[model samples]
Target: MNILHFFFGVCGNATALFLFLAPTVTFKRILKNKSTQQFSGIPYVMTLLNCLLSCWYGLPFVSPNNILVATINGTGAAIETVYVLMFLMFAPRREKVKIGGLFVFVLAVFSAVVLISLLALHGHPRKLFCGFAATIFSIIMYGSPLSIMRMVIKTKSVEYMPFLLSLFVFLCGTSWFIYGLIGRDPFVAVPNGFGCGLGALQLILYFIYYDKNKKTTDDNAIEMGPEKNPHQAQDQAQAQVKRSDKGSQNGRV
Candidate 1:
């Protein structure tokens, strides 16, 4: 492996770890309130899936010399699992059923990938298949912020989109993208390239609305209603982040 690739890979690992842990503050609040309130469990659930697929894709037998990808994603999988489990523990019954069902679906898909790759595929074919899975999910991981992005636009507030997380997303994605470029691995490069662009866009959106958000910060602090449909509640929760404001986290991996 090229030393520079290794260096960037390490950088990616560090930043990715931060990305995984960023939700701790939000999870802390769920614990404190003894309820998930309006928080949606989907991001954590989906992140768990991305981490699983990425980890598998990075294994030596699957892709070779990508241990850094495996290490960080494996750790992320553990962290996200805890967050999802915690969300389940505190979320309302209806919310529990929804997230639980998604969790099962994630497991089923992951199992299918593993079984098909190990049993039916080999060599470059296995690598390609695993890489395809990782890439698709990684792209989905970046796209997870769509709901939050919409909320930022509609409310004219960047309150839910923390500047620091956006910053880290850019930094981490850039590092991984570079690592993938140097290593000649499109699987890692393509999705992170997408992430880098989205991260940049998010930062731009935050700045564009920051001043406006300040003027209506009080009004924008809309409380969740019990009658909110699951979709609406999840939408609000998607815009639920910006941990710098004391832990109101929402989208992204």
Candidate 2:
């Protein structure tokens, strides 16, 4: 069991590393375009907070036998920082200010957690407090794709959701979940269990919609961006109906 625990931890580390670094592709695009486009930087900022909390929770004093948790999350924190900085660099003025303020808030929150954990908590109490903080943020990070999932169902398409990203979500979540259970740490287990479930749902969605439509991924798909126009869907549907009507008229003539 001990060996198995370590094995999963290693697996978890690898997958989580991929998850942390997965945004590299997006960042590269941002750099090439010399713009952040409409991409939101909130996820990266929140993820950095999650990583910091997890790192603190995984400490030897806070939680024993979980050095792997700290190892991976610590690396994640560094990576997310870079991503956040990049967002600030290329984002438009409005976006730059938004991300800037959020970054400051993350630092403040993390500082509070650190202070309380060190001064007010000890032993199991410290673990529970730190673990809870980590768990909440981790779950937020996992569920960040909720908007994308909604878009998939509404459009009946999986084109916007990348297959590799969904696969890694499942892999990373399952590995950490198993590692946590074997080590008897619910902090790691619960949030990851949620993530694993979400990942499975996404993959199921991808398969269900895969190849079902020969049209482009954006065909009939609702706008999934943060600033979608509410009337866009109705306009798209009306346009589709008009096209059908025109086609029928031409066929008859």
Candidate 3:
């Protein structure tokens, strides 16, 4: 049983690492294009906060030092920092100002939490406070993808939502839930339970709307076929007349 718990913990950490890094491809595109395009920096900001809180929660001051939790989330915080910097660099001035303001606000709030936890609280109280804070943030982070769900419904397309990311999130959640259950840690389990459910819903919506978007695209192409064919034929006729006229002039010459 102990071994099983350790295995699940490791798996959970691995999947969570993948989840944190999943946006690399999107950011890579943004970097290559030298624009933030349609991507928003808010989610990455929230994710960074989530990682910070999680890292704090797993620290010796807040709880037992779970190296797995600390390491992955610590790395997550670093990666998210890079992503947010890239976003700030490439995003328009208006968006950059907004994200910069939001980043400042997040930093202020996180600093307050750390100060409170370290200076005022200690031992079990500190653990409970930090644990609850982490759990709440994790739940919020899991639901961050709700915006994508709304877009999926509104556009009838899953193009904005990456399926593999959802899959990894679900897997990560499941692994953590099991690990928490076996280890008797509600703070870790509860949020992940919600995460699993939300991830599953996203996957279902993807499958449902994926085919609809494809069909709609195909129908639009078909509807435009006749409209394009006539224009194409007219252009060809004009080109043929020009060629014949040129040939006649050359013969006369």
Candidate 4:
């Protein structure tokens, strides 16, 4: 085996580990609230779809001697499916609709892109075209967290974001980039450049919000129920306090 291959493979494996751990924050939120209202299922659903696509794309190269990509992406699809199902179980009706719409959109667009590319190109050209399209989608998918990043900056609190997950995303991106470079997979490597950039920004924002000396602030506080009733505000405040306490505890450890 080539030394460079070994090195890149190692890096890829390490980064994959990071990606796996990136959902801890989401899981913790579920555990803390016994619900999934604040979290969105679109990302995980998209991730599963992406994994499935990767597995499908790798089928031709899935010999016993070269099944790494197939195996990893196939496993990814399975894991993400479980996560999405769990999310659906606890999500609100509106959120569920959002996820469902996103799922359909992803399926439609992904299918169309694959079909068009397959029909329009062949050999190395097909690979490049597919890779380019995949990179564009991956960049958009990974950049989906920017809104949350902005929320963090606005609130000066990492309440909705978590540090470890951000770190994992960054590491995952770096790993995939190395893996792509080593395997000569431009499609895989190119999108990860954007993923790494977004992930790093997320990490930076986390530190800015959650650092030891940084004070917590809530800028966009909104009322949850009827505003006319003074008692409603009190009740909402009490419930929010409970949720915030649990969320903070869950986040800290």
> What is candidate 4's lDDT per residue for 36-134, written digit by digit as tens?
744456677777666766654555522112245556667777777777777777777888888778777767876886787567766656655555655
Q: Write the per-residue lDDT of candidate 1 for residues 201-244, one digit (tens) a residue.
A: 88899788887425433222221111123367445545543343
Clashing pairs in 4: none
Residue 78 in model 3: lDDT:
95
RMSD of each: 8.5, 4.0, 12.5, 9.1
Of 1 and 3, the candidate ahead on TM-score is 1
Report the error of model 3 at residue 31, Å.
1.5
Candidate 3 lDDT over residue span 114-207, tens digit each? 9999899989999898889889889988887776566567655555456677678789889988887887888888998999888798779867
Angstrom error of the Cα, residue 206, model 4: value is: 3.6
For model 4, the stretches where C-alpha displacement exceeds 4 angstroms are 24-34, 59-67, 113-121, 213-253
- Residue 219 accuracy (lDDT) in model 2: 22
Candidate 4 or 2, higher TM-score: 2
What does candidate 2's lDDT look like per residue over 64-176, in tens digits? 99999999999999999998998899999998998999999999999999999999988889999999999999999898888777766776656566677788899999999
Cα lDDT, model 3, residue 213: 26
Q: Rate the local accuracy (lDDT) of all candidates.
A: 0.81, 0.83, 0.75, 0.62
Candidate that would win on lDDT? 2
Candidate 1 residue 223 C-alpha distance from true site, Å: 18
Distance (Å) between predicted and true CA of 200, model 2?
Answer: 0.4
